[model samples]
Structure formats: C-alpha cells, structure tokens
Target chain A: MKKFINAVDNVLGESLDGFAAAHADLVTLGAERKFVRRRELNRSKVALISGGGSGHEPLHAGFVGHGMLDAACPGQVFTSPTPDQIVEAAQAVAGDAGVLFIVKNYAGDRMNFEMAAEIAEGRTATIVTDDDVAVEKSTYSIGRRGVAGTLIVEKIVGAAAEKGADLATCVALGERVNARTRSMGVALTSCTVPAAGTPTFALGEDEMEMGVGIHGEPGRRRVKLAQADAIASEMTTAIADDLAAPAGSEALLLVNGFGGTPTIELYLMYNAARRMLEQRGLRIARSLVGSYVTSLDMAGCSLTVSLLDAETTALWDAPVRTAALKW
Target chain B: MKKFINAVDNVLGESLDGFAAAHADLVTLGAERKFVRRRELNRSKVALISGGGSGHEPLHAGFVGHGMLDAACPGQVFTSPTPDQIVEAAQAVAGDAGVLFIVKNYAGDRMNFEMAAEIAEGRTATIVTDDDVAVEKSTYSIGRRGVAGTLIVEKIVGAAAEKGADLATCVALGERVNARTRSMGVALTSCTVPAAGTPTFALGEDEMEMGVGIHGEPGRRRVKLAQADAIASEMTTAIADDLAAPAGSEALLLVNGFGGTPTIELYLMYNAARRMLEQRGLRIARSLVGSYVTSLDMAGCSLTVSLLDAETTALWDAPVRTAALKW
Candidate 1:
C-alpha cells in the first residue's frame, strides 16, 4: 500500500508526537506516549476520558480540551490499549469530581477500560457505548459496535461535565446520550492497515459493504453500488426506525466520512440524509458533517441520528475548545 | 467511479445546499446558489471575496464567515466560476469599505475574476495567489498554479480586513503573504471526476507524482515511491530554497491532505515536515494539519510554508469562525 508512514510500529508514536506538537497549545502527550491530556486540567470538573484504536482520529484525542475529554489513551492501529496506559491516564487527569470512562462496546475495549477502572484510585465509573444499529453482535464486539455516535456522546456529555456535573451525573448523561443515538455506515472501498500492507477486504467494482464497522469488519451484507439518495434512504430509514423517536422530535444529523471520502461528498450525503430524515418526521435541529471518526483510509461515510431534548441540544450548542472541534 | 453523488450536474448544487444547511449559523447561500456569504455581514469592514472551481472545498466557501471572506462563489467541479457569479457575489457583500477579490493564479479564474471586477460597481481590489513552487508554468496556468497557500492568504488578509483594513491595505497584505508563502504537492493516486467517470491520471503500483498540481496535473517529476522522510526532505528543501527566508525567520507550517489521505498519515507527514523545516533553521511559530484545501478524491498531500512577521502572526492567531476552521 502507498501510505505516508515510516514504520508500522512507529505509526502511533510518531503521529502522536506530531499531534502534540501541532496542538501544543491545547494538549500534552504523556510520558512513553501513554496518553493525550488537556494542557490545563480543570480540578473541579469531572474528568471524561475515552479512547480506542488509533485509526478513528479526532475522536477521543481531538476532543480533549475545555469542553470535552480530559484525556485519551490511544492503542496501536485496530488494537486496544493496555490497562497500564488507561490507569496512568486516569491518574493524571482524574480530579475531585472523579473520572468517567467513555468507551465503545467492543469486547477488547470494554475489558481493558474496566480493568483500568478497577486498578485506578479514587471514584471512577464507565459508560460503554453501543449505538451502532447495524448488528447486535459482530466479530470484535458482543453488542452493537459504537460508531460515529461516540462523537455526539463525547460532545454533549462532555459539555455537561464541563459545567461541573458530578461523576454520577456525567455517567447518567453519557449513557442517556448513547441510548438516544444510533449510527450506520457503508464502505465503498476497504482500508489498508499499515502493517498488513494490503486492503482488509476486497469487493467487485460495483459493490459496497452496508453497515460496515470502523475497523473494516464485515457489515450486514454486500450490495450493488447505488445512488447517493438510495443509500441515504436505506441508512436513514434503519437509523430512524431503530431510534423510534416521536414524530416531529428534534434531532442531530451527523454525516461522518471513513477517512477517504471527500468533504464535498460528505456534504452531499448530508443533504440526502437530511431530506430523508425530514421525510421521516424528524426535525434536524443540529448537524455535523465531516470525517471525525475515520477507519484508516476507507472510502465511505456513516449517518448518525441522535434524538435530542432541550438539555442535550443546549449542551451540544455550548462552547467548546478542542483540537479538531472549537467554536 | 465510486462516490456519494447523484448526477454529475447536481454535485455542486446539492453539496452547497448541505453546506449552507450545516453552517446556517455562520453563512447563507445566495439566490440561485451563485455564492455563499456570511450570515451576518459587517457593512463597515472591507468585504473579502474569493471563488474558484468547486472540488477544493473548505477553501473558498468553507472560509466564508466571520474574520474571513464575506462571500465566496463556487463554479462547477474543476471549472472556474463565471463572471456573473463573481459580480453577483460582489453586489451581495460589497459595503462602504468596498470589496477585495482573492483570486487564484489560474487562467480561467484570473480572467473571470478580472471581468467581474470591471463590471462590479465598487472600490474593488485583487490579490492573485501564485504560491506553488513546483513549476513555473503548468497545464492550467501561465505561471505557477496557486495551491494550498491560498488558504493562508485568505486567513491572514481576512483577519486584517475584519479589523477594518482598507481596500489598499488588504490588497498589499494579501500580496505580501502570497509572496512569502510557498507550497508543493505529491499525489499517490489520481482523482476521478464524476463527469469523466475515470481517474484523471494513472500511476504504477510503486510510482508517485511529486509536486503534483491540485487538479492532478503533471508535477515536477514522476519517481518511484520513496519513504516518508525522503519525500518530506525533497519537498521541504524545494520550498525552503525557493523561499530563502532568514535562518531564524518565524514560519507557519501547514500539511494539507488531498481529500483521500487519512488524518493519521497527515499528522505523520506534519511530523516529518516539521523536523525538516526545523533542520533548515526556521522557527515554526504556527501549525495547521488537516484537509482544508483538497482535490476531489485524490490520495495525496501538500505542504505549505508562509513566513510570519509580528503583524501577520497576530492576525493568524485572531479569532475567526468558518464552517471548516474556527478558533
């Protein structure tokens, strides 16, 4: 595969080094490259920490700042972080209000974050996200795999925490946000892991993988390539039906690209998805369209629908300062 | 070509609809979708206007908002906007302080923007950006083709305009910034325009186009794919040698992705480019790493370096709110 990489093992470390240096005003890298934490921690606020494999950039680490995550522990590409890394991160950022772990529902991630919570000091809690409506079980996850909805959870819940929510309040807000959110993705092409040096999967020229996972895992089924509106109809119908929010309910529509999709196409998908959601009687009150949670260099996009109440809407509108997100 | 688009003709219109919808708080689409203007225009400030082909998103339109362009016109994909679009945009946003058109150094773009200025009834000025150091002339232009450095020019000059710089001052600052900035790109794969329905160009499995243009035009040379450091060294040396800045000069380093490159690889490139610049004795006072300016779905990246003086540094740090960039 043609990629900008020095070596397979040094990918995460060197990327993190560059990330820290570029965003030096906002975040700091921990020793041994164990974690990325806010440059100035708020000692009175509850700490929100989240992380997973390295491919889904601007997720946990990019959201680390004033109104989002306190710290993030990144693992190798498509690999879960060790408990030691998590424990060290918690120790570094957990304040008087305590620490809350925002993790995707992958088996490896759940187990590792749980172990770290157990070993860490002070009050600690966990909010496991399983917002993907594609499948109830997958090869790497027992429940629905958390996808782009993870970003929504981090933003809303992190805003609440930034406003001085306690540990229990932060946990409740996070779990509620996760439950109210749903996401589904389609892959136009597979991504190549730097180490593997080949695409993770292969498809015919006119085929696509519907409801694909973030790590290039198998999706619901492979289907013929379709128009933007048709694809949007399928993904939006699935998410809206699964969400089952009342008609005319307010919602946030997010179109997330899987690394290789262009912003123009992402916005095009957003237009199609917004039309579909409006037809389904959901009011698009807030929207985010970009490549926030990516899957290496995969060429695809995911549509996330999050049911929003007044509190959540206000929280999402709250001011935030992060590397990838700010207002 | 696998892309999330409906019909080739509808690509720019539909994407602009979504962009306007997503950033309703910051911008508004003009009638007939000829231009994107700031939602709340500042009548007393010099209106910064820009336009070009559509594929390189977040360049003209995404930068239209507070502390940036007052309005931006978008043409068909890879085609320069018409004079009518530019004239209408000038009519919509030009105020007491008049209008300043920031045009890229392309034959089509320069001609169209010049025609619009002649017809536009206002105190209008022009800033033509020719920052590409790859070649003196390419397929699309008479001189160096403007690449990612246009973003830097918009940002710095837009900041000055926001702070009440007159038409002449804005033009002078923009031209100076353009002169100080230099950029070069490398493409691993060619982008497939929707209308063409095929790759714009081709490359062997182990080949790359160095100093490639944003439109996938031929670069300085096609060479065997090299390691990340080797590529970074060649690109950095070309820019630094051409810039010929003082050893201790302050500079801003921007590593921009060409749509299809992942954030991981972009940051890795940022790391490599940062090291090379430091070795050349330039103090990197500012850094921006992401896909701000892009070719449709090209898998590559471009590096941009702009010398920053005390005045430009503060302008760079000034608060601006746009769809793609905010701080």
Candidate 2:
C-alpha cells in the first residue's frame, strides 16, 4: 500500500516536533522527550499521569490538562513509551498531593509503567487500570487489558482529584470506574504504521476480525463482513454476556470507531445497537458515539458498557478540561 | 480500494443504533431522532443545540450533555440533517432559558439551521455560530469556511452556559472565542466517503494541497510534498501571517489530524511548529493536538490557533461534561 511520509525513520521524531510547535499553550516537552502538564499544579490536588503507545493520539497525550492527566509519554508509533520518559513525566508534574499513574493493562505498558512507578514509588502514588473485559483470566496472565474504559476511569479519578479528593479517594474511584466498564473491539482492516510502511496484518476485503486489539494485532475470531446491524449486535451482545448484566439494568453504551470508520457509520451502528438493547428491555441511560479511543487508522470499532450507579454517573458528569476533549 | 461495508443505504441508520446501544449511559435518542441530553436539565438553564452533517461525529451529537449542548441532529454523510430533524432537536431540548443553535459556516448547514432556528425563534433564544476564520465575509460568495474553530467556540460557550451564564453571556462568549480563533488545513490525499466508495480527489504520490476544506474538496493550491519541517513552516506561516497576532503572543494551538494522519506525525509537526514559533519569539500558552474534528477518512490534517486572553482562558478552563468531551 502507498503511504504519505518523508522517511520511515524520521516519521516519529518529526511528528512530535510539529505537534509541539502547534500546541505551545497546553503542553511542553520534558528533557526526557514526553509531553508534560501545561496547566498550573494546584499543589493540593493529586496529579494523574498516563501514557503508552503513540498511535492512540488523545489517549496518552491529548488527555493532558486540568481535570484529567497531567502528562503523557508518547512511545514510538505502536510501541510503549520508555520507563525513563515516564519517570521524568512523574517528576515534572508531581506535587504535594502526589501523582497517580493510570497505565493500561498491556504487557509492555504494565512492565514499563510499573518499573517507572516502582522507581518513583517514594515520590508518587501509583495505580493500574485493568478495565478491559476482553480478558478475564489474570491467574494465567498479567491482567485484563486496559482499553477505552481507561478514559472513563481517568476522567472519574481525575475529577476526584480536581475536587480535592485524596489519593486514596482517587484510586478507589479509578478502580470503581474500571470495575464497571467493559470493552471489546473488532477490525475490518489492519492499518500500516507510517514508519512501518506496510499493513500490520493482511485481511480479505470481505473479512473482519472480532475482539481485535487496538495495536493491529490479530483478534479472537475472523468473520465475514455481516450486516452493520448484525455486527453491532454481535459486538454489544458479547460485551453484555461478559458482564452478565441483566437486560433491564441501566447502562452506558460507547460505540467507538477504531480510527478510519466514518462518524456516519458509527451513528448507524449506534442506531442498530439501540434497537437490539430495547428489544432486550435494557435501559440506556447514557451513550457516547465517536472515536474517543482509536487504533491508528484501522477501519472498525469497539463497544463498551459501564453499569452505572448514581455515584459513577455523578463522577462521569464531573467537569474535565483536556487537550483532545474539552467541554 | 476495498471496504467492509455490507450495504450503503443502511449505513447511517444502523450505525446510530449501534452507537446508542454502546453508549446508553451518556446519551439517548428521543423517538423522534433527537440525541437527548443525558443529564437532567436544570429548569432555569438555557439549552444549547447544534447539528449539521453526519460525518463530523462528536460535533452535534457527541457534544450533548451537562455543560455543552442539550441535543444534536445527525445528517446523512456529508449532507445536512433535514430541517425537521433540527426543529425536533430544538423543541426537545429547549427549556425556559431557551435554545441556542451553534451552526457551522457551511451553506447547507446555514440554510437548514436558519430555517430550523426560524421555527423555534419565538420559543427560544437562537444564536448562530459563524466562527469560521476562513469565512471573512458575511456574503456567501467570498465567505470563509468554518472548520475546527467551531468546536472550540462550542466548548467555551457551552461551559459558560453550564455555569449559569445567561443566554446572552453564552452568545457573547461564543462570539469572542470565534473571533480569537483562526484555522487553515492541508491534505496529502483525498478522503473516500463510504457511499462514494472511492477517493473524492486524486492526488499524486508526491503532491499535497494547502488550504484544503474538511470534505476532501480541492484546496486553494496544490504543491509538491516538502520536508515535514517545511510543510509545518508553510502551514504555520500562512496561518500566522493571516492572523497577524505578532510574535511572543500566547495562543492555543490546535494541530488536528483530518482522519488518517497518526498522532506521532502530528506531534513531529507540532515540535517543528514550536521551533518555528520560538525562533520567531511567539509564546504558546496551551496546545491541543488530536483528531477531534475530522473529514471522512481523509489523509491530511489541519492547524488552528486561537489567541488567548484571561477571559478566554478562564472560559476554556471552566468545567464541562459531554459525551465526546469533558471539563
């Protein structure tokens, strides 16, 4: 496949420089090569920091701001950010309230962030977000893979910090959001990283993989392209079955575009999902329909549901200010 | 090129269903197709409603929530949502404080929103957001097109409203944010709308276009691909020259990936831009780098700068809660 890039090697470095130049107001690069918090630290509040691969734009970096993360480490394209970078980010942004590290449940991310957290354990409080419901057997593996649900946890935990909630409060809230949230994704095609300059994996035009990882890895199952409504049903149903939440329970639905799917198509899939849920007597109390978390330029989406209580809803409704998402 | 769609006609409706099912906690669609506000409307608070085309995902619908818009109408891909949809959205969301319409500066959007605004003129306070820096003239023939700047205005104004700033305050703040913002875009390759099933425009391997719009329309000028640094220089120079805010002035820089450009490349461009600005002695106080607003699978990105002041910054920092964005 053809790609638009100057050189494969220079793609990542050049891109970071360009991003910093354009967004001088909200972010600054630390000496260790990561975007640090631009907002003034309240000192009384605990700072939240998270980062991983670079392909997930708003995830690691775009989320840096007031009511969210204080800093993000952007690793090379699809790779994990280094421990050194995470260490610098923690030191640069930490305050008296301390810093919370919200690392995703990936092996590389876990290893790196945990190492950094261990190194900075004396300086900041650390927490892991294993919100992905896709994996359940932590007995044999590291843990559940953190996915888009991490954003929900970050926002809730960040808001707790902004509201003068202690580190313990923030950590508890983070775990609560993570516990309530579940996500599963599918990919229609594997996208080529600019530096890689080739498709991550090959798939037929008519075939799509369900339960796909965001980093262009193979999914649990490959299936034929079905009707939009049918595919959405499959994805949402899988999530519902995993949670085993009753049909009548109130829930928050998130239909996230992996990257390349158009908003129009996402909305179409959203409409189908609503019908399927209504048929099952489920009450949708809230919904988020967009590409909040993306998989490079892959052409597919994921479905996430968070069973809600009054407290989680209130936390979700708390205001947050960030680079990628602002209200 | 190959795609995974099962059919074209059912794309929108089905996606909407899937989205509602997935995000059932953050929003819900009224039977009439209105994306209703998830939070309980404070009886005395004014409601904000916005909508236009379907492809701009988080815009109209995703903005609906506590501090942003109360309702959104989703159009077919690249096409304006029908007048009836807008009217319904206005009626469903409007309350004692009235409703404000934040319409982008597109011809079809203006016409449809204008007509819908007329329908609710007597019942609600209608405010139109004509914040596109590209559209300098009020007259249709030479007017600037609205782009990423509209999203900023929406967020700021929405926050002001949520803080109990009256309808007039929201309107005034929205206008101020728009006045302070300017945006320009470039495309390396044309986007492919799923229904069209091919690229909207054919670009050569070494070609790029400047001053491109979001819909994959031909840009003001086509040129050869330059170094990433050179591309950043040209794009920023044009935007800076147009705004003429002077060096050393603090501004909020937004480097938005249209659709396909990865975050790494965006950050590289941002770093280049920062050096360019710093060398010119400009101060960037805050920056937003992501793909918040986008075209349909477009292979390009846009840069937006909103010169900041205490008032704008305060408004920017005000808390907000929405489906797509928070804080």
Candidate 3:
C-alpha cells in the first residue's frame, strides 16, 4: 500500500493518539476508553454522544466541541465501537438534562448504541440515522445505510442541545433532521483496508461505482465512468428523487468527498448538484461542500440533501466550534 | 483524465460557480470577474485580499468570510489570475483603512498581485510568502516556492486586519508569520491538470516523490516510500532545521493534505510530526490538520511549522468565521 502508516494494527490507536495530542485544548480523551468529550462541560445542557467506526475522521471525534457533540467513542476503522465504550462516553458526558445518542443506521452501530442506552445508568434516548438512499438493502444492514446525512443530524441536534433543550426535544430534533435528509454516493476507486493491504474491490480505470457505501461496500452497480457533471447529476438526482420534496421546497446540500477526491472535483460536483436541485425546484438553501464524511482513501463523491425549513436552517447556521464541519 | 469535469477550459469558471452557489450566504461572487468577497462586508476595517490559481480550493476563496480574507481572485486552473481581476478585486475590497495583498512567491502570482496593488485606488501593502524549503529554487519560482505556510500568514494577518489593525501593522504581522514558518511536502502520485488530461508526472506504484512542490514540481529527490514515522521525520526534520528555533521554542503545526490523501493519514502524519517536534524540544502550541492548501488531486502531504510567540499564537486563536478555517 502507498499509505503512510506504521503497523496496520496500530493505525487506529496512533491516529487517536495524534487526535488527542493535537487537539488537547478543544477536547480531552477519556482516561481508559476510546471516547472524547469537550474540555469544558458546563453540565447544564443535554449531552450529545455519537460514535462509529474510526475511518470517518472528524465525525464523532472532530465534531466534539462547543455547540456540538458532548462525547464520541471511536472503534477500529470500519468496525463498531463496543457497548462499553458508548456507555462510558455517555456517562462521562451526561449533564443534568440527561443525554441523547446519535447513532448511524448500521447493524453493528445500532446494536452497540442501543445496548449502551439500555444499560447506561442515566436517562438516554437514541436517534438512528438511515439517510443513505443508496440501496433498499445491504449485506449487513436492515434498512438504508446511514451516510453523509449524519452531519446534518449532528449539527441540528447539537445546536438544540447546546441551546439547553431537553433530552426528549434533542432526540426529536435529530429524528426530524434524519428523516428529512437523503444521500447517494459514487466511488471512482475502492479504498484499501489498511489491515487487508489491498483494495476492497477493483474496477477498470475507465469505470466507476455509483451508489457506493462509505465502507467500500458494493454500490448499485459499476458503470463506465462519465463526465463530472453526469456523476453529479446521477447522485443528486437519486437523492432528490428519494427526498421527493415539492418544487418550492428548500434544502441543505452537502457535497462530500470520499477521502481521495479533490476539491476541484467536489466543487464541480457541487456545481452540477446545485443546478439539479434548483432545476427540480428545491431551492438551494444552506449548503456545505467538503469532505466531512469519508471512506478510507476512497476516490469518489456523495450528494446529500436535507429538506429544510427555517428551524433546521437556523440550527445549521448557528455558530458551531468543532475540528470538522465548522462555520 | 479521471477527474469529474466538463470542458477543460471551464474548470475554473464552473468550480467558482459551484463555490458561489454553494456558499452564497458567506460570500458574494463578482458578476463578471473571478472574485469572491464576504456577503456582509464591513467598510471601516482594513480588507484582506489574496488569490492565485484556482486549484487550491479552500485557500483564498474558502477563507473569504468574516475573520479571514475579505476578497479572493481566482485565476484559471493552475494559472495566475490576470492583473485586471486583481485590480478590480483590490479596489472593491479596500476599506477606509486600505487593503493588504497576500501573494504566494510564485513568479506569476507576485507580478500580477504587485501590478494590481500599483493600480488599485487604495493604500495597500503586500506580503509574499516563501516558506517552502524543498529546494533552493524552483522552475516557476525564485528562492523558495510558497506552500502551505501561506495559510499561517493569511490566518494571522486576516485576524489582525479584522481587529482593525492598520495596513502597516497587518503587513508587518504577515511578514513575521511568513518569516517564522517553513514547509516541505511529498507526493506518492502526481496530479492531473484538468486541462492537461493526464497526470502531471508519473510515479511507480512503489516509488514516491519527496519535497515536491505544490504544483507537482520536482522536489529535492524521489525515493521508495517509507513508513509514516520515517516520512514525518524527514519532513519535520527539514522544517525544524530550517527554522532552527532555540530549544523549547513553541510551534504552530499545520499538516496539510494535497487533496487526495485521507484524513486518517493526515492525522497519522500529524501524530508523527508532533512527536518529532516535541522530541526536538519544540512545544506544539497550536495545530491544524486538514486539506487547507491543496494541489488539485495530488496524493501526498506538506508539513508547515511556524515558531510561535504569545502574540502570534493569540492571533492564530482569534475567532474568525471563514468557509475554510474556523475555530
């Protein structure tokens, strides 16, 4: 592999070490758990906890700061964190207002987080996000897989929690955001699992994978790679059709990179995606165009549209301080 | 050739269109020129102007919100912006206190920015960043090429300008930041210029390019790619040697990805980089790890270290809302 890493076994450990050491001011690592919480917790607002596999940088970890997540538990790359990690994180970040868990809709993630919420010694609720409309089913998922729309869930719910909303209110807000959002992704190249030391899948140079999952899971099907505008149209059109928002509806668009894609391509994709959304009558409202969510070293892009009203848009625009997805 | 683009000639224009459309709330695009300015411009404060080629997505444009750049002029992909674009942008963004131009040390960028400053109807000063220490000279550059350290100059000076620092003060601050920083980069694979429709250079699957320039220019040498620790040591050692700061000196570390590298790799690189700097007795006071300065879709990274004093660190931490870098 051409990746810059030490032992494959130590990839997640050392990366977390670096994350803790590098962002010491904004967060503090749990003493004996793979969890991170804000450095300054006031214990007045509802605590927000989110976690998943480790490959998606800046998600659960990078989003832990003021006006965002209260705690995050990171597992091995593409592997779900254990229930123990989630419980410890929830306990650590719990405030007087109780806690809310934001779990992506994956078998491993949903099971582990649900178990944690049941066993945690505090009031807790869960909002599972399954916004990826890539497939009706998957090898390891019951429903559509959660993808980039998790960012919208985090931002909106985190803002609500930060504003001293109660745990029930935060949970409702997260569910609403997740339900209103939809995403579809495409991959130009499959990412290598550092441990496997090879690509998860293969494709010819001129071919591409549409409706790809974040973990290099099989996409809708392989197709001859087309132009940037075409790819953007495919992803955005899928998301728009799934969203099925009325012509006069508005949306918060996120053009996410699958780790290895360039910003130029992301912008190109964003241009086409925006046009598609506008032409379809979804007024392009607030948008975030960057790699907030990524598969490991995968070359591709994803389009996510969160149909929005003033409430969701205000929460998104609310000031957030995080290592990732900031404004 | 694998990039998602329309006609090669439309890369820059359409990408800017996506940027403006994507971030219409944060910035306003020129009606007829390639410039982006803050949507809510304040006329009393000094305005910060910086721009160059368009491929570096988040650089001058992404940083064009409240506490960062006031305006950015985008050239065609990998090509310098013409003097006319710069003159119009400089004149438009200039405030009562005047305007400050931040230019990279590339020959074309310098000449065009200098020409624009001369003709713009405002009091202005320029700070050219030349912190890349990969080689004594480069093909399109004299001395050293400006690389990731330009972010430090822009962040520090932009904060100062937003705080009402005079033109002279902002220039002096920017110069100091530029002087105190050093960077070195490497590429595992060459990037393709959308217009060129081919990789800028070729590398074997096992070979790597060390100390490469941002535009995929040759570095000091190419060698078999090493482990992450070894590569980090190489880059940090080179920058630390160039800085030669006294023992226990503080540093602000910026680990920038050249677009294609994964955030996991960037974090791993950051971990190794922090260890190396700490071993050499340089306390890493502030750190930023992301793809802020990119070279299209190149697969590699650059390490920038700016020896920090209390003043510079304070400026770095000041609250600024930019589409790119925000605390």
lDDT of 2 by residue, A200-223 (tens): 889987788877877888887888
Q: lDDT by residue for model 1 over A5-41, one digit each (tens)? A: 8888898888999999999999999999999999998
Query: For residues B1-327, what per-residue lDDT tens digits would candidate 2 score against the true structure?
Result: 434344776655655555555555667776745455554566467777777776666566666777677777878777777778877776666767777778777789888887876776444554444434433465667377778887788777777787777777777777777777778788887887778878888989878887787777888888887777777787777677767877678887777777666565566667767667656666777676666677867767777878888877777767666656664
lDDT of 1 by residue, B28-114 (tens): 999999999999988889999999999998778999999889999999998899999999998898888999999988899999999
Against the hidden true structure, what lDDT does model 2 obtain? 0.72
Q: Can you write out model 3's per-residue Cα lDDT over A126-212, one digit (the tens) per residue?
A: 888999887865564388888989988988998888888898888888888898999999999989889999999998989999888
Q: How many collisions between residues are there in candidate 1?
A: 0
2 or 3, greater by TM-score: 3
Best by lDDT: 1
Between candidates 1 and 2, the one scoring higher on TM-score is 1
Q: What is candidate 1's CA lDDT for residue B134?
A: 91
Clashing pairs in 1: none
In order of the candidates, what TM-score does chain B achieve?
0.98, 0.91, 0.97
The lowest-lDDT stretch of 10 consecutive residues in candidate 3 chain A is A132-141
Worst 10 residues of 2 chain B by lDDT: B127-136
Local error of candidate 3 at residue B212 (angstroms): 1.0
* Residue A249, candidate 2: C-alpha displacement in angstroms: 4.8
Superposed Cα deviation of residue B278, candidate 1 (Å): 0.7
Could you tell me the lDDT of residue B169 within candidate 2?
A: 77
